[model samples]
Target chain A: MGGSLNINHLLFLGHGALWTIGLSVIALVGGGLAGFLVALGRVSPSRTLRLLAATYVQLIQGTPLLVIMFLSFFGLAAIGFNISPLAAAGASMTIFVAAYLGEIWRGCIEAVPRPQWEAAEGLALSRSQRMVKVILPQAIRIATPPTVGFMVQIVKNTSLASVVGFVELTRSGQIINNSMFEPFLIYSIIAVVYFSLCYPLSRLSRRLERTALQKKPALA
Target chain B: MGLELDFSVVLDRWRSLLDGATLTLQLAFIAVVCGGIIGVFGAIGRRGGNPLVERLCGAYVEGIRNTPLLVQIFLVYFGLSSLGLKFSAFTVAAVALTINVGAYTTEIMRAGFDSIVKGQIEAAEGLGLSKAQIYWHVIIWPGIERVYPALTSQFVLLMLASSVTSQISAEELTAVANYIQSETYRSFETYIVVALIYVALSFVMRFGFWLLSLALFPRRRRLGTPL
Candidate 1:
């Protein structure tokens, strides 16, 4: 029996690629909002909040994303709630990305020089006002490069959503392979698609990192 | 109906779980060691080899870095099989993991190499050391010593990533979890147990790396300063 690759398969993969991009966006926004809270909690003056946030990061970082995906997919259903695959994948990515992005943002936040904090305090600004007006603005500048770098990770990770039955690029490739029996070509195409999506962000991250390095001397 | 969890069934398969964990560790160990070797040479190539070699190394690192490990695994697995090369899943997983992690290690090691000041190499040359001696003493050892922490964490991440090999039916921890959960119908319990095992494994690996660094880099241990 002979089976051939066709335009229909390419269109299916194209649709899947869109879903992949869609899932990555969902993870980015959802994870970004939650991770922001985590970053703040990590740097919070309250001892208990700091400890809880640190614990959350440790627990999530210690566990693999695959397990988290599985838990959200099967565990929620097991607990008597019918969970959709997209919801499970998105929720798991949110939880997973929040941990990593929280850690990265924490580093960026802390990288804001000590003198800036002191100057803000010297200005008689309230703690909230100081953070909003001084610390966060500087931290955002430091955070941009790494945050863009993490976007590549988020995009690559959306492939894992395929495991829980979301019809993303990788899963669509698998579906096509099941019918066409052409694993190498289809998977290579999938890899190229991912590379195209991720390489730009990687380049941007590297460029930003370089500029950040260059900006340090000017700042000083 | 309320949720009730029972891990007893999963817990009863502790021996199989242990075997799977051991396999995961073994797979990770092979990948790290092999990848480290490739990385050191690759770093050197990128840093000092001919222009073509440097370009090739750069391409390899960028290519691997920009793709998901899942697809890479599929490509390697099918690519090899389609080429009429028959290998076991375990071997293929190890090969793919080594290749995947090697790209990352190359980048890290290249950074380490860049941080090796030119003056250090000149000093080694001033001492009339041979090329091999200068490379070993002036460059790689210290470069690695400085980047030990980064290297350790990378290897730990590699270990965690080894779970992905389960998709290829390489009987690692995650694959075992899949089987157990399917058999017992306690998916949550199985994955929770597997997750805890992974956490424990990472901690063990981190500790082991610390011990190893202490042994390998006497300067760090004695002087309490990075190289």
Candidate 2:
């Protein structure tokens, strides 16, 4: 046991890493769709719709993701709905990611120059055409960097899913640490693995942010 | 889909939840202050031009930025104890949180510091002002003012993140809720109430930061926004 590191341990960690990526994808895609709606709602013509979306964003963004996981896990059960860990984690992540992403996209949408909106309206484009062809096309450029930046947050946050008994990377690391009694080695490796996954995205996001800043006027 | 919801069990433990939320806010408030000090120092160290200090600051910022808070908590709490260094869970939790937030605060402040116009600093220097005076008047205060919103948001995020301390059994909000749930066997009601409380705490934190900004930066409050 001392001489050779356990291949099985390595294998289990590898599997957990894959699930971490899987959970991230689920959160990202699901969150992106929900966020799109939230973003639209934030900019909706109706004041109630805008306020409803803003409240949703504020409530979700203020609370920690871990609490959301708990509510989704146990709250669903208490109301007598049978739920799985996957559904709980996935649902919680969707809501959690949507809040932040929606805000991010909202900023992007609003950042589209006022004149451009006027020009689109002047051109007699339909509302949908104004959004898709004129507005969203421009907002996507402003949104790319922060959107990618939040992805790193999403990946890091998925670690919290472990507490609800979803055995992702951190949970698997805890399991291994429990047996091997190697807190330093196990957590160090876990941190390194996380670093490896997140560092590139961090660098890329910063680069995007810098380039975006150079091109766009600062928005308060 | 077909069950009764009862708040009585959790409501009986209202005092416990209140204290927990109080502890959570206190932790966040203390960490923001302490971490701001560290962040300012780290920013200076990175820009200080001393090779070793710069490298050390860079590594510290990157290291903390890259790892998950849960692992950082473990290394500080369990790993250190394994290596014969001993401390209470609360101390370890605070230390870990401070270190984590300090790095983020460092990066945010660095951006603010970098954006200060060269002309302003040169003007301070041309007035026979000492470097320390120049930094205090021109750099630190204004930097904090410019990045006030970003810093407040990060601190709020830190407040939310204090939940991770439950992993170390630090008796913070999430930990208190955990204990209440175990005692009351009202897991759903407990978490729902706690979630709402966290939402309330964040709103309060935002209001507090806004008030503090007014007191700290009268120029900003009077003048149009700086950033």
Candidate topping DockQ: 1
The second chain of candidate 2 has a TM-score of 0.96
Superposed model 1: Cα runs more than 4 Å off: A217-220
Residues A73-97 of candidate 2: C-alpha lDDT, one tens digit per residue: 8777767776988889999999999
Spell out the clash pairs found in candidate 1.
Answer: none
For every prediction, compared with the true complex, DockQ reads 0.81, 0.69
Please report, in order, the local distance difference test score of every candidate based on alpha carbons.
0.92, 0.89
The CAPRI class of candidate 2 is medium
Model 1 residue B91 CA deviation (Å) reads: 0.7
Candidate 1 chain B, which ten residues in sequence have the lowest lDDT sum? B218-227
Candidate 1 lDDT: 0.92
**Model 2, residue B86: displacement in angstroms?**
1.9
- Candidate 2 regions off by >4 Å? A1-4, A213-220, B224-227
TM-score of 1: 0.98
